[model samples]
Target: MMRLELNLLIEGLHDFEKAKRLGSLSNEYCRESATIYLSQEDSSILGVSDGDIVEVSSKHGSVKVRARVRSDVRRGLAFMPPSPYSMALLGLDEHPSIIKVTVSKSSGEPTSLTTLFTS
Candidate 1:
């Protein structure tokens, strides 16, 4: 698998997530929150298709999330809402609006917020 450094932009909660009250542990909430949007170019480079699981890592930590190829995203960049998956990667030590992350295809399941705190 190929791993590439991509800039990850942490975004606000999606409408669905907001409706779910941000901390819901439902499967729908988990599926939405644990998704990473990538540019077509980036997806192609990583050989990832929509809904494919990918491992995103930083110096702080790593999290697995489903990938979504989006035309709105720019190459070398990724977008994900503020959720447990993204938070796991960012860690608790430092907070940056945007940061570089190593991304690659993964066979693991999407990470949940509970797992992050428990582990």
Candidate 2:
């Protein structure tokens, strides 16, 4: 796979900070329903388990992350934490309204057991 990097130019950091201070971005950490389907299927795939290190990538970028398989057996589906690590690849063009995410398997990349918060 070809290595790719993304450059994001966030305009007016100070203005965003001020807006956040005024509670404009107060719910930045809120969690919402997210679903990932491995492919267009219904029966579901097995073998992978929760806490497993997986790589999610897109044409724009890629990142290694943990997987949290749901118990309901939604074939070809997976879930992950909603954090900066996951949100970094998302496009914020429709701020406060929409978030478009393009993701795929980060195959061929190395996987580790360490968490991002670990020192």
lDDT of 2 by residue, 19-113 (tens): 44554224332211111323223212323344333455543334565344444534433333343444444554535222333333343332222
Please give the distance, in angstroms, between residue 20's alpha carbon in candidate 2 and its true position after superposition: 17
Name every residue pair that clashes in candidate 2.
38-76, 44-75
Q: Judged by lDDT, which candidate is best? A: 1
**Looking at model 2, which ten-residue stretch has the lowest summed lDDT?**
29-38
Best by TM-score: 1
Residue pairs whose backbone atoms clash in candidate 1? none
Instruction: Give me the runs in candidate 2 sitting further than 4 Å from their true place.
Output: 1-46, 72-78, 94-119
Q: How many residue pairs clash in each candidate at the backbone level?
A: 0, 2
lDDT of 2: 0.35
Question: Which runs of model 1 end up more than 4 angstroms from their true locations?
Answer: 13-19, 91-93
Per-residue error (Å), model 1, residue 118: 0.5
Q: Write the per-residue lDDT of candidate 1 for residues 14-109, one digit (tens) a residue.
A: 654573684577767777888899999999999999999999999988999999999988998998888777777775566666888999999978
Provide the global lDDT of candidate 1 against the true structure.
0.85
Model 1: what TM-score? 0.87
